[model samples]
Target: MNANFAERLAELPQYLSAHVVLSMCALLAGIVLSIPLGIQAARRPRLAAATLNAASVIQTIPGLALLALMVPLLGGRIGFLPAFIALMLYSVLPILRNTIVGLQGIEPQIREAARGIGLTDRQRLWQIELPLALPVIVAGLRTATVWVVGAATLATPVGATSLGNYIFAGLQTRNWLSVLFGCVFAAGLAIVLDQAIRLLEIATRDRRRGLAIGVGVFLAVLVAASIAPRFVPPGQAGTVAAGESPGAVQNIAGQTVTIGSKAFTEQYILGALMQRRLEEAGARVVRRDNLGSTIAFDALRSGEIDVYIDYTGTIWATVMNRSEPAGRYRMFTEMSAWLWVEHGILTLGRLGFENAYGFAVSREFSEAQGVDSLDDLSAIAGDLTVGGDPEVFARSEWTATRDVYGLGAARTRSMDNTFLYAAAHDGQVDVITAYTTDGRIAAFDLTVLDDPRGVLPPYDAVILVSPQAAQRPGLAAALGPLVGAIDDDAMREANRRVDLDGDTPAGAAAWLDERIAEQ
Candidate 1:
């Protein structure tokens, strides 16, 4: 009943609806695709081996990676399409396997009897073979139901709204309530769907027409309820109107803008900031948060998102594939030009802050070991274990830093960014690739080692506007004032409010807005 919990609860209908629709659609598609393939495969041993092996291989792929791969494969399309495809593929294995088993297990006597009665092959399949196989096929469906629902949570990073949003955002902001809410609801949905299918299974097996009818009706209602919200008019029912305040800008009224945010606390705070600013400018804003780094940029390029915050170094290193170090001013200038020239993405200038990746260690360790720079750490590298978020180790920056600083001997540990600081603080990791603006740096009294070689590029926080969005009336003007508006200290404090003080991202954004206003 607290405000934080209430806020999350209010978002439930939106999140749950999307979650339900995605899960159900993916499950239904899997069933449709699998049943036919299973029938064909059941008839031939070679085909059965090929189809089952292919599905098993798909199942072997990690869910998150499979979903991530879908984004690029679908030509950078995010949200529902890619997520649905990935989940459908994931749902195939169990259902297909069960279907083949069920059909093949049917008694030869029953099939022979049907043939003896002058029943055609098709008629035998529809009347006799399928009826006997119904229970097993339904069991496969039940398993698929559980899997698709669980895997659907990982859809958040690919820009699909699901219960995974709760888990991803919760983990970043350390909000256990949100995490629990998503898990409970997702599990509940899986159980409910599984039980509903169980009812149909029983009815089919026992020849109970009424029970079958009731289950059919229940599913129809569930699907209807899940998709009903999509039909609601904007600014009505569950929708909140933009620019309702007295100070709202008139020119931008009714213009819709979509904002993207990567999966992390700072990104969430910045995203909320942009959402509020655009709303104040009389623009209806939609947010796609918890997106992966490349996914966010791709979404912006495709005009799926109007604007989002990104770092100059990320663009230089990842997007442009440049490993050479470029100073702050030169890097920003070149990167901005490249964005516009290549993809028409407009850089709105830096926000006077940098969230560069820095190697950090406990202050006590820094003092005791006399490690004040990457040079110092290099000498003792073999004796230490370095931890970082999964992406960092794979990045060119890390590769450059490692080669330059002779850190090949150091042990590497990959973990969630949320756990990096605590791991280093508790000596579970001797060092971590810490974001410079993270509030935990100060809170944990960690000392960031200086990079004497300048191998790591500067990561100046910059706002990027999509090509189509830049042409919107009053949009650029409304966002113009935010350029060079915030400093590093202010950003760090705002992040601290969310990461340590248990404030919501919106709350932290509000505090940041007030702080920026006073300046």
Candidate 2:
């Protein structure tokens, strides 16, 4: 095996252990807290209905949103605690509802027999009621165990290292093998945990003494191993947030740096390229990839990560909330000054390309309609439908485009980024919000309409560094060489290697780094 691949194989134990810790802790906490509440609710039908309704509402919120909400609720932290809480909330309903069902299903005759036998309420619960309800309660455990385990995969976005780490990274880098590994491992784990719970449920039957003790001991040890680490100091818990690698050692040139990337293919390649360049400059680098759209800014300000590549337009529109468009240099000037003043972040010069948003249509459609610009599209706006990632509809640029071009009643379709290209290619939408540098524009032979109004500001990819990282020796000088190095065609081809040719992000980065170094 290649040395690097072997190194990755060695890290699996670390990732697997961290994943198990998060999932098991969440599952155990869910079972322990939900059962008693379920019992109390069974005695009060009105309360049961209201409580279950609330839990159902919680389950409705997307898992990603729930995890993001916890970041602020927990005071700008992301990782184990927030992930654990979110998973616990998700597991509540099944366990809670089943607990209520199991408790209330007990016959009145059974309760009366216990009462006449001189048994108190608490004694009856432990001896008679619980003994009979054990199977049903175990069924709830079976359900909750599976739900929490599967949902735990979403924890990757929150900075928790679950099996999802592989999936999220793979998807961003276009590495299908990594994605398959994550999914298969997570699914296999879910099946095993469900089967174990089923065994415990079976043990609730009489004449299953051997199976009962064996399965009971297995669970006890499994849960015990998870619980024991909670009492240890966090650093010793064998799990870590970003940048907590063991030995805490040196990077290139005996210096260390952390690079961040938003959740996209281009960002992944840029982040990897930066890390590679930093390594060549003799600094050791760590990576925190797959951050949310705006999360990268906050993470940099708080020193959770050191550097990331962000677009000038994104900062102008999203961070500054500016609706006005300006020339490239002017927008960069304002953006750099604002970011420096507010967050102490440094915009390390542009990387020589503008990946701005453009409205695109098929070459044939553009030619047949003679639609060369936004104004031309606007003239026929009613006859066309627009589609893009949901962000395109909510962003200031979209609002400006809509108002300036008078697309008020034009049909709009919002979908996932993965589907946008195919949708436009198949003529599902007449126009699309295409990133100017996307390789698919060429592959699909689409014509990018001109923007006479310049509603969207320039989107020059620039490196951003935290205030502290800026002070490091030679950091700025080391990265200065990358400025104005990659152009539109270069970026498109780099992206094509990953998005079209199925190359991994790291592989694409390595190739680019070599080509740039040779230049």
Candidate 3:
């Protein structure tokens, strides 16, 4: 396990590096903008109150939500810029409030004495006031440091790489080690940064030592920032792509392929597999990871992305808006026809596995209640609580599930997907909507309720490409080898490596590619 942990650590350099740069840039942006805002507000009480209130409001918006909101604002694109702006906005409040407080907290006598000595108002502020207020300002900087460093993890969802990638992928795959490693790493980085800021604030109080110490301080920061991302070396860099998941590339002998993925462990793995294969077949590859489930479809249609994988059931319920329960073959047949007709999107082929949606309970709860299936769950649904991603409660599949299984009275909680397993395992919810291949079912000793009535639609993973992408030379040949290439055991194992064993998605995908290549 320790060797596995070490190997995983070897894969995180780029992610760790990107996290530091993003966090620091956001902090720098906040300091550059908010300090001046604070200065002006301090002299005007009404302005100060309004400014503080506005910053406070920004802080209240959830980090992920704020990042997502940047998509359309930046003209329907996502990546470092949108994420950077959100981080800067989030970093502003603490710095702004503390700057105002520091400015106002100065003793009247200090300014009076400077004036008595013929110092101008501006002179007093720079010489006597700002220096005195430095400590408090730095205290705010420290708070902002901790805040941005921690929040930067959310960048992964918006298609920016960060330490959060490990946490998000791990939670979905039911990988405790991966989750713990990410949490510990992120927390460790935050503490080190805050402490360094504290030291800087202290060193600057004395002019003589501060000058020499400042160089060391910057060197320390640069070294610390550069160190984390350098661990995994070069080629192993996670293929998260850069700058809005890229549009298209011109490499691979002028052939280009864009691969996109939804925000889940399986999607990340699948996207990487697709990207790697296409690249091998002499086409340039672009990866758009962590896209919303629906966003993947739209991107493919618009040709913003050239390739991705989606489930049959998700397409049936969310995209096609059909309510009929059909066999896997029928559903795919109809879905393929509907997509080609409606949007000119093409379904290349099906990956040989079903990552189906179902209900699950802890082994303890299942055995105690003797609940073996959805029917059994339905019988006691009135007393049980269910947990899932926020989308599940409102989706057509869930509504039909409730109607068929008679689970309408069950208490429900909507939360981030990563926490559902913990919620169920810890008894926060008695049942959570579970994915069939989720590694946690075995690891955490939980039972998945049988969907005997087939309330949930069949979910066969399929390769989807835009009409434009499908026209590329050798595109079908590049992608054809993947059909029926991976089975349930293989995908579940790959997912487990990401979710539980702490492997990065690229590393996991690379490992899977090796297995397929050997065959």
Candidate 4:
């Protein structure tokens, strides 16, 4: 196993940079906004009640839902902005509640003594109340910091590149190393930040010098804000010269173009193969693989990625979030229309492979029950249990088809894709949602049922690029030949090489490079 733990740790700097910066920004914003609200609420009971109530309401929402809600309201394309706002909203309740409690807990006699000394209201707050509240406020900040760090992991679902990228990518590929990597880094960040805050709290214990803690935190934040854009690396920054956008020329002699892929093995392999081809053609190529589908699309649009392969069926069903009956032509037409209207996204062309949906059952279950097509399976559904990934139940094709085709099982349970596959193979589940091109189908010798009712959509593997990106000179030409190069067998073999053979994606990519070069 070429799984270099040190190499993975070295890569940590790139992934953690975004997550740490966003988390700190949310915490700082929460502190600035909550302090005044907390102070006012402390002084005025009714105001305090209302402010805390609002913050509490925000806290009640699931972090994922809150992040999702921000998309429609703030333009879904603004990736980090929505996550930052949602995280900030989450930070407020703990800070506000603690702040109010801390200030209100101050003895009435202390307030009276400050006023008796001829101190003005502002003086009373700065000289007395704030100093007294410091310890408690720090406690609240500690609570909020932990919450924000954990919840920020959910940001990857909304297309912001973060450490959670490893978790999602690992889950799909069943590479536990990547998942563990994400968990460790995210947890480490929280501990580090909390300790830093504790050190500041200790250093600024004196009433007169307490504000130094706030000043130090503020300066640290300013430094981070100054460095974030450079961390993300601006378009055409550092390497590419001015006016030299990625994919701008029909060919490039020295500049590097990054290509990204979704988490699945096929996508990862294809992405690496594309980079290899580009590099062979004389351009320096960098690979960013195992990104989520939505995220990969976003990066392409942002010019963070130049190109990668995608399925036409995915463009129709997942990206456009649309439903149409199964047929390659119908799906292609509908998706092309939607992409043009909504995102100016264009499907360059289709790969030769048709990687459509198909349900799988253990060989024993299929043989025992005489189940084959969905219609036959629906007959015995009341006696069988079905397992699938959580998202399948909510997706239109799955939902609409389940109802339209009258496909049912005695019970439906949602698990992650890998788990679903395992359950069906072990006979713990009689049936599962599966993809035809998935290598596990062969690994477990599972039987795929015919969709006689045609409930499932045609998921022909296709490549999609942003209209703006496609129009750039040479991108289409560079990518045009790879279309229709792969078949279902080739895809399944590639996936098996990773899933069953325990090969790294880079190794799988190299294998694919050899195959494509031969073709």
Which of the numbered candidates is closest to the native, going by highest lDDT? 1
Clashing pairs in 4: 310-462, 311-462, 312-462, 351-484, 352-484
C-alpha TM-score for every candidate: 0.96, 0.85, 0.80, 0.86
lDDT tens digits, residue span 135-174, model 4: 9999999999999989998887665657877777677778
Ten contiguous residues with the weakest lDDT in model 3? 237-246
Regions of model 3 farther than 4 Å from truth: 1-3, 112-118, 173-177, 209-213, 216-259, 262-265, 282-306, 319-346, 361-376, 389-391, 413-430, 438-454, 466-475, 484-519
Candidate 4: C-alpha lDDT: 0.74
- Point out the higher-scoring one by lDDT: 2 or 3: 3
Clashing pairs for model 2 are 251-284, 252-282, 252-283, 252-284, 253-282
Better of 1 and 3 by TM-score: 1
lDDT of 1 by residue, 1-519 (tens): 799889889888888888999999999899999999999999999999999999999999999999999999988888999999999999999999999999999989988999999999999999899998998899899999999999999999999989998999999998999999999999999999999999888998888999999999988988888799742124211122332333335656688888899989999999998877877666777789998889999999988889999999999998999998889999999999999999999998898899999999999889889989999978898898999998898899999999999999999999999899998888899999999999999888899999998998999999999999877766676776678989999999999999989999999999988887778
Candidate 4, residue 277: Cα displacement in angstroms equals 4.2
Which stretches of model 2 miss by more than 4 angstroms? 1-18, 165-179, 204-256, 279-286, 467-480
Candidate 4 at 198: error in angstroms? 1.7
Candidate 3, residues 1-519: lDDT per residue as tens digits?
Answer: 586577558647766777777888899899999999999998899999999999999999999889888765665455577789999999999999999999999989887889899999889888888898888899899889898989998887666777887777666655676678789989988987887777666667765476548756774676587655452332221232222122222223346566778877888888878777665544656566777776566667767778889989999999898998999899999999999999888898888899988888999999899998888877788898999887788789889988888999998889877788878888889999887887867877888888888778899999888988777756666677788888888888888887778776777899888877777
Between prediction 3 and prediction 4, the one with superior lDDT is: 3
Task: Assess the local accuracy of residue 80 in candidate 1 as a C-alpha lDDT between 0 and 100.
Answer: 93
Give RMSD to native, each candidate: 2.6, 5.4, 5.7, 4.5
Q: Would you list the rank order by lDDT, best first?
A: 1, 3, 2, 4
Best TM-score among the predictions, by candidate number: 1
